[model samples]
Target: MGSKHVFVVAVIYSLCAVAVASNPCVSTCAGRPTGDYQSRNGCNVYATCVNGYICDNRPCVAGTVWDDTLKRCEMTSTTCPPNPCVTSCNGLVSGDYQSCNGCNVYVTCNAGHLIDNRPCPSTLVWDDSLRACARTSSTCS
Candidate 1:
């Protein structure tokens, strides 16, 4: 291959390496206090960071996924959203809305800002249509 073609291929290869080798905790836990933190890579995975170092990566209990809002593992039978908590409240009217993270959690928004993330009562799930915590029937999945 010509020199120019070689350079372009090398640059593209480097970019691909960077894209595939990212660790979600590297950005999420940096400068944060020592504690368990959720990993954006997967719902069942979490990480423990201590003094800017990822000391451990752990999995949630079977049948559960890490709940970033609640800071704990929560049960879920359905497939998790690909990119949870990526939904923005900006430009949205103030109201209770289903969280992008899990079905059992909801977010409170005010004037286009996210105020809080709250979990539905145990054994219940947030009902987006009703905008309330209701008994989980078939929709929680």
Candidate 2:
């Protein structure tokens, strides 16, 4: 019975310790609009505090901007990715893209944005029902 009690107490203490130390990030006691300092295990972060302020916001490299998702500088995409613009168009890569609406109507992306936008034929219009180009005078049916 004594040994069992000791084991139970150890397990509870371990659980408490794990819960308290689970979060890796430490924040200033002041909290949100979070202050400029945080520390863990006696090690202070942002050690380059100048005049009580740190240069946390570093400038991005030329032609690149800080990405919220990556938290780093990267070239801006001209078109949206993962589903590229215009269902039929190819995914944007190195700023090149291809997407089509219906059929003849298409959009191209250069640098992750639309460029060289036009219809495949001056007298034709996209027809979703047939999934192909149709004459301007033709009905979708």
What are the TM-scores, per candidate, against the unseen true structure? 0.36, 0.20
lDDT of candidate 2 over 1-141, digit per residue (tens):
697666444432332222223322222242234333222211111112344444443444554433333333456411111111243222322222223333345454444456544565777754422224567412121
Q: Which stretches of candidate 1 lie over 4 Å from their true place?
A: 1-86, 137-140
Q: All predictions: root-mean-square deviation over Cα? A: 14.6, 22.0
Query: Candidate 1 lDDT, tens digit per residue, 1-141?
Result: 997666444432332222223322323466788887655335566667788788544887866766555667788422333223315565444566567678878887666687556888888887553457888622245
Q: Could you say which candidate leads in lDDT? A: 1
Cα deviation of 53, candidate 1, in Å: 62
- Report backbone clashes per prediction: 0, 8
Model 2, global lDDT: 0.34
